[model samples]
Target: MGQLVRGVWTADADFPRDADGRFDRAASQFRDMHVEPVAGRYHLYVSLACPWAHRTLVARALLGLEHAIDVSIVEPVWQDNGWQFSDRYPDRLHGARYLWELYVRARADFTGRVTVPVLWDRERDTIVNNESAEILRLLHTAFAPLARTPRDLVPEPHRADIDAINARVYEAVNNGVYKCGFAGTQAAYDEAEAALFAALDELDATLAGRTWLVGDALTEADIRLFPTLVRFDAVYNIHFKCSRKRLVDYPNLLSHTVRMYRLPGVADTVDFDHIKRHYYLCHRSLNPRGIIPVTGQGAYLRLA
Candidate 1:
């Protein structure tokens, strides 16, 4: 819940919330125009811990655009400064210490949530886009001509259908868990939980007969949902009190999660350590002591 206020980092700014105490996620800033699909001129900034950011990383790998677009992964922890680069994952573009610093560099008076999965335009010295869903679309299509991947995640006929799937999936399953976890009251939690599981039940049934969500092959819809599903059992199920049903409890979802993880390059992006530590340790509003649980990542791997 930290943000830059006129280029100054604030540890505790007024976290935007509605009157009902529901968490209000800020809209990503850089999403106006398209980034030119040129090789070696753009960079992707992401955190492996964040599902939203993770979505972009998975799409990058799936498209086989490793050489075309460069990526710099921030460390797994969130401190006084929002997402920071570890000594291991230094900021390659500017040698900046914190992610928010890059935001300020782009817009000197930037006053918003400094989020990740930012499509950075190194040539123009600013971000191209920060929204993950848009980034997924751009990654799938904008770079397709130069990409080596065989399949297209978003075909024309399936566009409307995929958008429809994302509408519900984003509300109930993807953002639903956050609504439940961040709910300020029992009523909000209850409502969120009901919707979350209902969506999961419907989706599990929908996926019961097939591997992909919309069509015969993997689409942007699958990329959008996989991050949340992969994190559910490990973090959300326990830490977020999404305990009504573990991801494993649903056979189809568990199968789908296992399959998605086993996909080429998807496994590498699922950083269990980062995912667990970021939620357990960083969200001090929920976890004051910052004690990370000693859960084994193998438990999830064995589910497949």
Candidate 2:
């Protein structure tokens, strides 16, 4: 949860909150940037545990952009120095031990939270875009010519519907869980928890008779929502105190999660061990003992 101030890493980082105790997530820096579609010119840095970063990973896989834009992964657990690169998952481009170093390298005085799903321009040696939503679109469009697959995640006809669904889901679901988990006051938690469940209830009903979120085929709307749903029962339900209902209780939503998991290359992007460890261990304030509760989540996610 640490952030950079004038390119210096501050140890005592606290999640920002409004006067009313509602968690206020700072916007990602490095927006309004562009990356060329040339193969091998771009690289992605991501954490498997992050839902936002996972969105880009799924897009990369679905579009068959693996051969074009390679990736470097940070260790699952975050530390005082923030996302670290261990011997197992070293930074391929630079030998930097921490992700913030990359941010500093990109801009000597960069001031903001150093988050992942960063699209690094290997040629320019700087970050092209750190926002996942923008990175997802880049993978879907800018890099489309280099993609081996013909899958259009954002179909032209379904653009409007997909955008509308993404807006609601992003606010009330994707970021809502964080608001619930990080809320500094009971009132804030109550408000966020209420919105999270309301959005889930609506989504469950939406998927009751439909296989996909928007069009006849899988779209970005489903991709954006899947990461949150996949992590809900295991992480958010308990870790975030969003225990009003487990994801499994919503039959349609659970079915949608399983269907997405069954997709080729999509399941491979999910590392349940990493996902569980990162949340349970990284957030020491939430679980001081760092004890990860066991659940039959793996059995639920399996295709068989």
Candidate 3:
């Protein structure tokens, strides 16, 4: 709920909304890239709990840059000061105590929401990019020569179609769930919930025969959509009130999700334990009692 103000990390607790109680996510502040792929020079700061961060992890694995890009996972639970690292968590890289500390170190008076899936350039000692979408593209192509498994998730010919599909999925499904969950008013929640299922229905219909979102080949579009779908039935269904219909109810959508998970190296990126704990425990405003549920195996079992 807080963001950096003029390069100074200020706890603005309620800075992300207009007065209407609708949830509005802030744009990521840092947006640049590393043209050269150097082993061990870039670090990924991520949270297993965050779906956006999860996308980068999946891309890193799929592109076979695990050895090239070092990663540090933060504890799933968020504190009042925001995401922090711990001895229990163990920073494998520079050993920063908190994620925000990385932000401050990068720019002494940095201001903005400190978000995850941060691509840090060790050589420059600054953030390469904080937006997950950008990170996914960078990981997919930037380190191609160094990739253990050389594959193009986003090919040149399919770039336009991939971008179109990504826009729809991101707006109506990926971020839509958050809009529903974090909505401050009935109106906002209603709009988000309706838009979410509508998009799901369209995707289900579209994927009735196709193997992937863009083409026969898996693209960044699929990676971007997968994390949210994986979490939908598990947490978003009941907790976020995105229950117009469970993902299992859709034959095509369910199969598509399973297909993505079954992709070699992709499953390892998913951590349901962290995913469940972070949402239930960290969002104090939503689940004030801080109770974690042990309910229906949900759609996750289908992925297996």
lDDT of 1 by residue, 1-304 (tens): 5888999998773446578877567788889457677889888999999999999889888888888988998988887788998779999888889999888888999998889988889888998899989988888788877687846887888989999999999999888999888888788789889999999999999998898898898998988999999988888888888998888788888788878888898888888888998899877777789887776446766743
For each candidate, the alpha-carbon lDDT, in order, equals: 0.86, 0.92, 0.84
Question: Measured by TM-score, how close is model 3 to the native structure?
Answer: 0.95
* Candidate 1 stretches greater than 4 Å from native: 13-15
**For model 3, how does the per-residue alpha-carbon lDDT over 132-168 read when each residue is reduced to its tens digit?**
9988888878878888987898789998999998999
lDDT of 2 by residue, 1-304 (tens): 7888999998764678999999898898888456678989999999999999999999999889999999999999999999999999999988889999999999999998889988999888899899999999889888889999847888888888999999999999999999999999999999999999999999999998999999799999999999999999989999999999998899999999999988889989999899999999988889889999986778778643
Clash number for each model: 0, 0, 5
Q: Of the candidates shown, which would achieve the greatest lDDT relative to the real structure?
A: 2
Error of 2 at 122 (Å): 1.0
Off by over 4 Å in 2: none
**In candidate 2, where is summed lDDT lowest over 10 consecutive residues?**
295-304
lDDT of 1 at 150: 45
What C-alpha lDDT, on a 0 to 100 scale, does residue 42 get in candidate 1?
A: 85
Clashing pairs in 2: none
Model 1 lDDT at residue 274: 84
